[model samples]
Target: MTDKPNESSEPTPPRTQPVVSGQAAPSPYDSPTGEIPVVKSGAGENVPRTEDELGLDPEVPGVGERTEPIANRPAEEPTEPVTPAYAFASIPPAPAAGEGGLRRRGDYRRGTLDLGLLGLRLVVGLTFLYHGLQKLAGWFHGPGLDQTRAMLEQGGWKHGELSTAMLSVAEVGGGALIVLGLATPLAAGAVLASITDAWLWKQGMAPGFQYKPVELESILVGLAATLILTGPGRLSFDRNRGWATRPMWGSVTALVLALIAAAASWIYLHGGNPFTGFFD
Candidate 1:
């Protein structure tokens, strides 16, 4: 042995630490203070390297940082779901028909409403009819056509003959139709137009002196409008017609047409503005 050393025992190579970014890597036993003591088994055999001997810091995890590996984390506890209270509630029943209750049947006051309409028609129709006859035939001590024509001319109405004719026909014919409840919407429209002219005239739109206390004309206009909207009722000739029981779109159309016609007649035939009064 002394004479010739064995090749394996000739010289052992030096162990070198791994280079990490040109710096020597620390050994597993390296610590901040120095090399850490290794734990051993009871038989004096070395135990597998613990975290303390591996040079890792023993600091606790901060907030938001994981304390354990994902595979080692405990499963979250399951929660019981809540249900809505109304889901099991009962529905309320509908109210029965009675006083202050829902009306589920036909109108019981139909007869009363029809009677009221009849009375309204009579008063309006007869009043207009009387006036119309007075102007046309000199009835009830009224001036006849010649006098009426003269009166129109004095009241700033041009085309006296045509104006007188139209006025007489609208009042007389329209009044008669309203009384009989025949073509009620047209009758109401005609009367409405005539009354509107009268209202304008009384307010001194024409050359005549302004009439004080125009309540009669105002009342007449309102009544005419009421009849137009309410229909003729079941007591008259127009009972079978739609306008008789239900004055809706057709009634509104008739009213608008009547108003247009009245405006046209006043402006064109009378040569006067309906909106302006004598003072204006």
Candidate 2:
């Protein structure tokens, strides 16, 4: 017998579709679009598509759907433009005082200065108020208006009642306004004019314009001028006002007018310039 190869012992070729009489056999990698086929490793398993697979063009095989990278997709554009972080940050954040910021450096010092100014205002205002009440209503063992008028007349005031009334009004109205810090410049000016006249009156009564007799009046005049120049500070009704923050030309003008009124009162009403006596 011829030694022919046994059919059961020979290796079998891979199973494939039969070729037509004049056509080539189709390959496992060949598809209708002429692109290579994709074989997933985990067959029948729900394997998530990779970024490359997700980016494939639906119309074209083996091509990306978008020109941009998978990370920069058009579907994520709406959320990219939206910045939720700044939705509630309308105003810029400000550092608090004492936190090493230049803007808030003097906040604590300013607060202490305002408090000191408030205490000074209270003391000066209450003193003037007490004296005003004494003259107007004779409260606190003070001379009544009638007695004040007589005293002014005896002291060479031609219009004693008018002088007493003007003094009372200046003390009461100016002191009250200064205490409340309302119309601070005007109130200080009124008090300054009256106090200036009182200081001059004392100077005229003393020998050779002595300072000892009118020391108290001088201090009061200085206090009134200080208020005119410095304003009522931040603890007053005038807080945030131009005069309170920056007492400039307007306060200077008020001081000038007050001094002029004082000199005029001494010249016209008293018939003598007490200011000229200072030189002697």
Write down the lDDT of every candidate, Cα atoms only. 0.83, 0.80
Mind giving the per-residue lDDT tens digits that candidate 1 earns over 1-280? Answer: 3887556856878898655596766666566677567878999988868687665657867889867765888998898887656766688657765845435235344858899999999999999899999999999999989999999888888899998998898899999999999999998899889888778766665444444546799899899988998999989999888888877999989889888887777777665544465546
Clashing residue pairs in candidate 2 (N, C-alpha, C atoms within 3 angstroms): none
State TM-scores per candidate: 0.59, 0.63
Residue 64, candidate 1: C-alpha displacement in angstroms:
93
Count of clashes, each model? 0, 0
Give the alpha carbon lDDT tens digit for every residue of 1-280 in model 2. Answer: 5698656866898899766688776676666667544555666554445657566545463455446555776574444565457776789778766566764455445657778778778877877888899999999999989999998777666688778998999998988888999898888898889889888887876557578989999999999898888878889999978888568999999999999988787776665645455335
CA lDDT, candidate 1, residue 10: 61
Looking at model 1, residue 175 earns an lDDT score of: 96
Off by over 4 Å in 2: 1-109, 275-280
